[model samples]
Target: MGDPGGTDYAVSAEFYDLLQAEPDRRRAERWFAGAAGRARHGIVDFGAGTGIVTRVLLESSGVPVHAVEPAPAMRTVLMSRAAAFGADRRARLTVHPGRAEDAGLEAVADLAVAANVVGCVEPAARRALWRAAARALVPGGVLLFDPPPVGLPDGIEALEGLGPVRMGADSYLADVTRVPDRGVLRMVFDYRVERAGLAVRGAREEFPVWPAEPAVLVAEAAQAGLELVAAPHPDLLAARRPHG
Candidate 1:
């Protein structure tokens, strides 16, 4: 989770949900809910990110949920959402402040997830997460994650139009450019907001991500003592720890 705005998700935190509403659900959210519905024990959501998936997990799964998020801005939003939940759901949720690798969960979860978060850090950090999840999971538990759908292009590629999401008179727009630099993928998010045809605010948010291709991802998981399970989608991954 490399920082650009003095914090990991400082700039994008406000507009994240609005801009990512549909695409985020389409990516893996539906499946995430289904998995939670089928879960028996507990769940660990690494990089819980504004409690989007955390909300789903809390609703579908009767088990306790540990939501881990590192960014203060993102966590603030996450806490807001979790606090608004009814007593039952709120009681089952515990929000933690840390990265996935630093979450000292010891064999307490039936499932562990790193939703759309694996590429946020470098290879070593990703491996640390895998190992941490392996340690936190029950012997037969599974670890799941959504990897980046697209990587940085050979040099630089830009997409000028993403959306102009309208929430009343305010219009939010997002554009992105991908740059391959120094063995990492840098995604620059250009965000703008308009109030009744007047530009109000804008931000250029940069995120450095690891381009973990499928083969390399699998290898890394195996090295952390987890074996690849049948993935729900070709773009997603699930790895299971050995039954001891």
Candidate 2:
């Protein structure tokens, strides 16, 4: 499950505010607060787009924050937002220009988080990213993140079926529906579209979208030498690098 539909931060960065406003922000904050508590030092928001969660951790939780954003445009927005939150002060913040896998954090951070950014890569790449984050942490440091879901909107499949849409291809239409369970919400992605080359050509397929399922993701982390400490919700899970 590489970044299907091409998850471009430069493009998505513009609509990031809308994306965060959904239940996503609330979900992330809960896990981050818990994960940071395990850290003796401070926390780093890996792939911290626009610094939304970063600001929340700084303003609400009063945690020292460091943000990593690879997209230049997103980093720009994040820095501006951090400054507004008064996160530039030593007591509150630091902003870095990097990605989850390549951030040159000076020391092993207390926590590293990647909220809603794991879906940007294919599964193999995502595994590599997890390993990278694990390498940046201290023995007891934590890593938290959420992958999209196996169930996306049906419309998205319809749209993707139109053809394997190129990275910079024109945006297509998609509608998402929520299937509620006792605890978590499963999103069924529905897409509608016609083929690109042959205007008359069209089709649809349902991809079992398991964005970032806790079982699979946690297992991957464990394989990378992380220990699953807590997973408050399926959509939100936390693992800590094992201590000696």
Give the winner by TM-score. 1
Index of the highest-lDDT prediction: 1
Off by over 4 Å in 2: 1-7, 18-25, 60-63, 87-91, 151-216
Give the TM-scores of the predictions, in the order they appear: 0.90, 0.64
lDDT of 1 at 22: 66
Q: Residue by residue across 103-191, what tens digits does model 1's lDDT show?
A: 68888888887776787777777788888888888998988887754455778888666679988889999889988998788889999
lDDT of 1 at 17: 82
Q: What lDDT does the true structure give each of the candidates?
A: 0.79, 0.58
